[model samples]
Target: MSLRTRLQGRFQLMAAALVTVVQLPPVLWLCWLTRTPLPALAALGVSWPYLKQLQSPWTTTPRAPSTYVALGWWSACLVFDVLMLPALLAIRAGTPADATWGLAGAVALLLGGDAVLGRPRLRRRTVRIAGLPPELDGYRIGQLSDVHCGPHVPEEKVAGWVSRLNGLGLDLVTVTGDLITHGSSHVEAVARALGGLRAKDGAYVSMGNHDYFTDGEQLVRELERNGLHVLRNRGVVVRRGEARLYVAGVDDTWTSRHDLSRALAARPEGSPTVLLAHDPDLFPQAVERGVELTLSGHTHGGQLGVPGIRRLSLARVITEWTAGLYRRGRSWLYVNRGAGTTGPPVRLGAPPELAVITLRRE
Candidate 1:
């Protein structure tokens, strides 16, 4: 193998090893201790095939088996974490046998409920923005992001999301990015699905970290081919009657391409501006820059959560603004939970969401 190939091989191995290390303890606890044989088999069955594939050198050919296996493992990990609570309790409390059964029953109930409730659905939110033009009041904007379009994410799911957005009669639609999971192989399919979306103003997209992994430039080209505007540090104006609303999009902050100054430079001085950023962490920066409204969707609200308890999301550890709306003074940010899953095909309390934000003049 070439020197570059060797280095890449080592990196992939390190990553696989790290994932195994992170998952091993919890898997063992749920399986061996709790006497949950299914989770243990699932953990090994899914991971072993993918681990074997990783041992092979990287190639252009799609590793569908490995990819699907990895997704199964990720889903298994989610179930294991949920069962851990009862599994631990069963071990420490008397009558371990009964507790083991309880663990299985709880897991089944939770998983079944999650599968039904966690399906991607449309959620409408009204944001009253100060200084919004009177003519622009009650304007609707659709936001979708973090669509990890790969083997696990069905094309029909993408089509359904597009259809829902089109049916909303939205004035504007924004996709914050990560359209595909890893590579540009599925770009055409994603673009085709999104091409069905309709809006009065236009459909615009910003780059995400995953987009960068899949030849960001090519992805941009494909999206533009489907009539979606790929804004990379650029601004556009949407005229509503006599009012001019500015819309700007910066590249993915995770890739260090986010430039608020360049993005805002094209906007007219007094126009109400809406900024599109993939990561919500830039909310403070946008706030400082006097951006009226910002839209984002990177954290997916931990993908797993406890309903009615917002703090239950693991995303809190990374971002204070995990999901929903947050305001700092006159600036507002709405982080969509996203319309798709990433690592796993499953979701818990944090269901896949398509945010329809209606802007009302305050």
Candidate 2:
């Protein structure tokens, strides 16, 4: 077998082992307390199919649409199982088991059901840049990111997003990496799907950490071949009438070298520039460089957020600018929640987004 296949097998085994370690114990403990294996068996039955599906190579096969839903529910079970651990402990201390189980089940059902219902949505944000060129005012840029196209996220899903993007009549399109989950194996297919995207200045992409894991160079080449421009520490001048806007893209800071200075070095002083960097962590660097706007992805808006919490997402733990818009001085940043998922094949409050950013002169 190939090295990748061997690695895949080992990873699957490791994941299965980890899941068992986390999930099997609670079920077993509950069973031991209740003197029955039914609960444990039921939990295993609910989660087994998803674990089985994980063994398959993500890039090699097309998954059934329902596979994502099943996996989402399975993920909810795992999450609730963990969340209920404290209550389970309380059960030993005289708390009622019925109430604990009911609450856990209810929360899990709501969370998982919400994820399945999270349709890809177009979120429109208008950014007012203080130094934005008058001619570039009302410029609509379509931004997409973190399209983890593979088994869990099928081609049809991506095609649908592309169709939506085509309807926007955008001036420019930018995709901020994580194009595929696995590697170069699915690059062509993803390229083909993304090839449908068209804009006035065409589509521009910056590599992400996952893209690096999936063979970054090959991904860049495939995207370029499919007519999507790969911006690797490079700058392009986009013109509208007599107005000029400099667009630059940096390599992923998580897995690759990123030189914001190099990417924006050649741009004329005080000209409006948009920087495409994969991670939002690099927004400070872009701001320092006087980039008018920076676009990023990779957080997926944390994929889960508490319902009543305002502007709170799981991504907040890792990134300050998880989703939507944030401003620093004269520079602005917009984080796209992404079009696809990586691990659980689900999204909770943070739905998949096709962000339409309209630039306005302040």
lDDT of 2 at 106: 49
Return the TM-score for each candidate structure.
0.82, 0.79
**Residue 233, candidate 2: how far off, in angstroms?**
0.9
lDDT of 1 by residue, 226-254 (tens): 89998899999999898999999999876
Top candidate (TM-score): 1
Instruction: Flag clash pairs in model 1.
Output: none
lDDT of 2: 0.78
Report the lDDT of model 1 for residue 335.
Answer: 89
Error of 2 at 2 (Å): 19
**Pairs with steric clashes in candidate 2:** 302-315
Once fitted onto the true fold, the runs of candidate 1 whose alpha carbons sit more than 4 angstroms away are 1-26, 29-46, 51-77, 84-118
Cα lDDT computed for each candidate against the true fold: 0.78, 0.78
Residue 316, model 1: Cα distance from true site in angstroms: 2.7
* Least accurate 10 contiguous residues by lDDT in model 2: 57-66
